[model samples]
Target: MNLRVEQRALAQSDQDDVVVLGPNPADTTFETTSTEGAYKILGVRPGLTISVFDMVIGADFAGRFATEPCVAIDFLFEAAGQGWLLDADGERLSSLPYRPGRIYIMAAPKGAVGFYDVPVGTRFKGMDIRVDTTLWQKLGAGDILSSLDEHHSLHIASGNGTWVGVLPVPPQLLAVARALFDSAMVENDDLAFEARALDIVHASINAMRSIQPAATIPPRDRRPLQRARDLMIAELSYPWALDGLAREIGLTQKRLQTGFKAMYGYSVYAFLQEQRLLEARRSIESGEVTVTQAAMNVGYGNPSHFSQLFLRRFGVQPSRLRPSETGKYQEAQAR
Candidate 1:
């Protein structure tokens, strides 16, 4: 394993937490902890790193944090605060609201800085998998890398530019994350984790590819698609038909279908189903509702059919996501 670990203090203050896991320049696996929280990073192979961060901030730590430019795919499973990314000249590049179940891809040039300021008691939790350009090339994923380069100016070297792209955390990607999280708990073999981490990187690349031929929507067409998206999000439980949706958006059914696919790379109803199931999973995991209730809330009246769909999407039953039962399904699979 080409692992390397180095630790450094974020600032001179005694209260500032030191990266228990040294800031690795290459492949490494380490865990860090402080009064506020803990973090673990695993980078056992070339061109890939997986990290889990759970932290709480009591004050502004802007001047204390820094990072190298790299591509990052993030799954924000839990968060209760806000963060910001700043360019070398201190221009704000992005404002990150720590919303649960949100996934995003971002590339920051080498000179960029990131910091978070949360209330004294706010908590944050997320998983980040970083893959460098070297790995992209090695995997023969020039098209995927090129897409990012073209869309976000990601090809620009450090200090030149930065880019961020946000998308819903797809069910398939979530399953990979859950598997990685589970492996972290019961698997001590470095090879095992490395394999799983690589799987994650591959899945991330494919997720980007699956949303192919990214194009900008003209304002005239964008408005109606945005309206339709907003309506679905606002009323997931609403019984929606293709004709009704197109009429409400002042477009013919065929036009709406074409425009929706062009804008989102998914059919109108397909996107809605994804959103509904994602929301239902979140609701079940958060303990805000029972499995059946979650199904009903997402417009599924038949609990049995809903459960089957949930299983198909997430590879686990809705009940498995509850806090008390988390990972039980994975354990059963292992057996």
Candidate 2:
């Protein structure tokens, strides 16, 4: 393990310390300590590295990493504040809102600098993995790397180029992350660690490939679609028709349908249905409304039909999510 510490002024007569640990690929166990918290890199394999960090900041903090030539995937499991990354020229690359279920992929060449900042007293928990391109080639995944290079927008500065983007973290990928974090508690489970790490790497690559390129709408054409989406979300109970919506948005029906499908990977009605079910689910889970009421709130007049669609989408009946009222009713009956 390689360790380095840097100190910077926080206030008058006060300083904040930041420490980073770089472990060898062959090392099975790696750990680091700082004033705020402890960090661990549990599973280290050739061509891949996995790390978990839990820290509370004492002051405004920023750190930079000089990364090797590789592709890095970062999953933010829990965070209480905001953060951003800077490119080699000290320009901000992107706004990274630190929230649960956020993931980012970075394809960087040698000597790339990664800058991160978080405000004081913010708690952060995350895991990151880095895989070298040569190792990917040796594993017969050269095509995956090539595809990322082709599809990703490159950020070139000072003769270095990096491709980076935020990805949607699906439930399947979250399950893998949970398993990996749990595995850290078991001692001497090298094989298990290795298997979980490989699972994450493969899942990341698959997620990248599954991204629908055609669904990416150009910036200038996005405002009307966003307005349409917002309107749908805001008025869940409103009876919506494609032609009416197109006229309201000053678009033809065909253009509206085509743009909705191309931008969201779903038709307008399909997206509306998804949003209705999701809102109904939230209402039921909150226990403030009955299943029928929740259904009706989302424009479903037939309770039976709503229940069927809800079960199909969420794999459970809406009533199952509602708070139990049986005990109170039983008490009243006995009295």
Q: What number of clashing residue pairs does each candidate have, in the order they appear?
A: 4, 0
Tell me the deviation in Å of residue 245 in model 1.
9.3
lDDT of model number 1:
0.63
Per-residue lDDT of 51 in model 2: 66
TM-score, every prediction: 0.67, 0.59
Which candidate comes out best when scored by TM-score? 1
lDDT per residue for candidate 1 within 139-190, as digits (tens), equals 7765664555333311112223555555656676777786676565445566
Q: Summarize candidate 2's per-residue lDDT along 125-201 as a digit string, tens digits.
A: 67777777676667565665454432232211122466665564454566577667666533446567677778888
Clashing pairs in 1: 3-27, 6-22, 6-23, 7-22
Off by over 4 Å in 1: 1-35, 56-65, 109-111, 115-120, 149-160, 167-170, 185-187, 219-257, 282-289, 296-327, 330-335
- Residue 8 error for model 1, in Å? 13
Model 2, backbone clash pairs (residues 3+ apart or across chains), number: 0
